[model samples]
Target: MIEEIQEQVAYYNARSQEYDEWFYRIGRYDRGLELNQCWFNEVDVLKSALQDIGEVNSILELACGTGIWTQELLKIGKEITALDASSEMIAINRKKLNDTKIVSYHQVDLFSWQPSKQYDLVFFSFWLSHVPPTQVDDFLAKVYRAVRPSGRVFIIDSCFEPSSTAKDHFFENENEIHQRRKLNNGQEYQIFKIYYQPNVLIDKLTQVGFQASVKQTNNYFIYAEGKKINKL
Candidate 1:
């Protein structure tokens, strides 16, 4: 497990250059124009949901990646602190932002990460799937502590749809917690990937003191929002 986690970090670091292509439905990730359009349409839905949560004064983003979500977050967050395990990912994110007046970057492993201070909103995109199944409880506990009471925790992750990945990759077995992913250059890596049903994620959040709700977009993505409400 330790070795696999390290490999996952290395995989993201190596794939950082082409990561945007995956999100944009370019290269091997394209599944024809209709499917590509559907992907973008759902992406808009996720973006809208993030924006609809309203503006926040302090925001913390985990596994922020190449600023795809960071750009949207900039509009709503008064101040932002972004964290990622890969320095390469952070480098791409910094370059894409082009300016950093409202943001700061930290390269840290999420598995062993601790929040120095809480925030009004904690957001992570396509990161929940990378949490190992055995470590999810501990990870959610960290998130529960990362947000202030009544603060929100929003998450975005991929569904089990095989088409969500590159055309050359084989995705199967929803019950499996591991996935083999191939980069554009044809290098492959085994990473932790656990797909969750809406109810399962909701229950996971609830276990750590969050009032949670989850939604799945057709066959592409699952997005969720949770609030940490103090119990009377």
Candidate 2:
């Protein structure tokens, strides 16, 4: 599993240039690279996850592709450590947020890297879905450790409904995911085949000692927030 993830990372790194161009070109529309806000959930969902955070002195955005959510962190006046596995993605993000003082960018694997300091808010936007099911436990453990006492980890990613009759409801199979990809963006990039199962993720978070729950967003993404159990 580790090797598979590493291979996927290498592939993404190699195609970083192409991906950069592709997204930048798409920036012309609301969904484009001009900013990654459109890909995010509605303002209300973002607000809900952030409401209790009040103000953060420092925040960590793991696997922060192109730093879209990192920008949102900045709006709330939090200094951000935007970490990505692909150096090319970090480079593209840096190009967009040229101010280095506020946004400290790092290119490192989330599975192995350990933070020297805890953050008030640790966020992974549309990232958990990419992680393989077998490795999710370890991933959740790391996320649990990165956050400060009473701080929370916010995950917003793809989720499917079990009995939704909607046409583009939740993905139950590869075909549905492919259809979603085509509908959202005409790209068929499935570097690593992944699927989202909401209840399963919540259960894993519980096992890792987090207080977890899920929120259905925009009838598309699943937003889960987990709070690290702090020692009093």
Candidate 3:
């Protein structure tokens, strides 16, 4: 399991250059006119949800990949702490943001990384799904501690829709938690790719003492909002 996790990191490091293609719906991810449009429409929904949260003084972004969502978080966060396991991904994020003084970049595996301080908001996009099932409780527990009292934690992750991924990648049974992802060069790597229903995610959040709600956009994305329960 540890070795496969390392492979997952290597895959992302190698894929850093082409990672935007998936978000842009270019290359193998292009699914023709209607489906591609639908994908963008749902993406817009997620964007609006983030904007609706308004602004915060500090934010912590986990698995901050390639600055795709970091750019969005920038609009609402005055100070952002971005962390990722892949140095290559962090490099791209820094370059894309032009090493903005408002953002602090750190390269660390999510499982091993600890929060040095809490923040007004905790955000991650397309990240929760990558967490293995066994580690999810521990993962969300980390998210819980990363937020301040009544602070918000927002999540954006993928649904199990086939069209949401590259055409070359195949979806296994819904019950399975692993998937094989292929880079453009035809190199494939196995990684934990767990999909979640809205209710299930909400339950997970609530179990960790968050007052949470989750919603989905048709067949593409599941986004969630949770507030750390104020015990004080």
Question: What TM-score would every model get versus the actual structure?
Answer: 0.98, 0.73, 0.97
| Consecutive 10-residue window with the lowest summed lDDT within model 1 | 163-172
Ranking by lDDT: 1, 3, 2
Candidate 1: residue 49 Cα off by (Å):
0.6
Candidate 2 residues lying further than 4 Å off, grouped into runs, are: 14-44, 47-52, 160-190
lDDT for each residue of candidate 2 in 1-232, tens digit (9 for 90 to 100): 6676776676566655555333232422233332335333354566556665667787899987775566667776458888999988788778767756888888888767777788888888766766766667888888888888878888876545332222233446642322222123333323444556678768888888789887766544677888888644
Residue pairs with colliding backbones in model 3 are: none
| Winning model by lDDT | 1
Off by more than 4 A, model 3: none
Q: Where is model 1 more than 4 Å wrong at Cα?
A: none
Could you tell which candidate, 1 or 2, scores higher by lDDT?
1
Tens digits of per-residue lDDT for model 1, 1-232: 8999999998999999999999998899989999999999999999999999998999999999999999999999999999999999999999999968898999998999988899999999889899988899999989989999889999999999988888998876988999888987789899998899999999999999999999999889999999998866
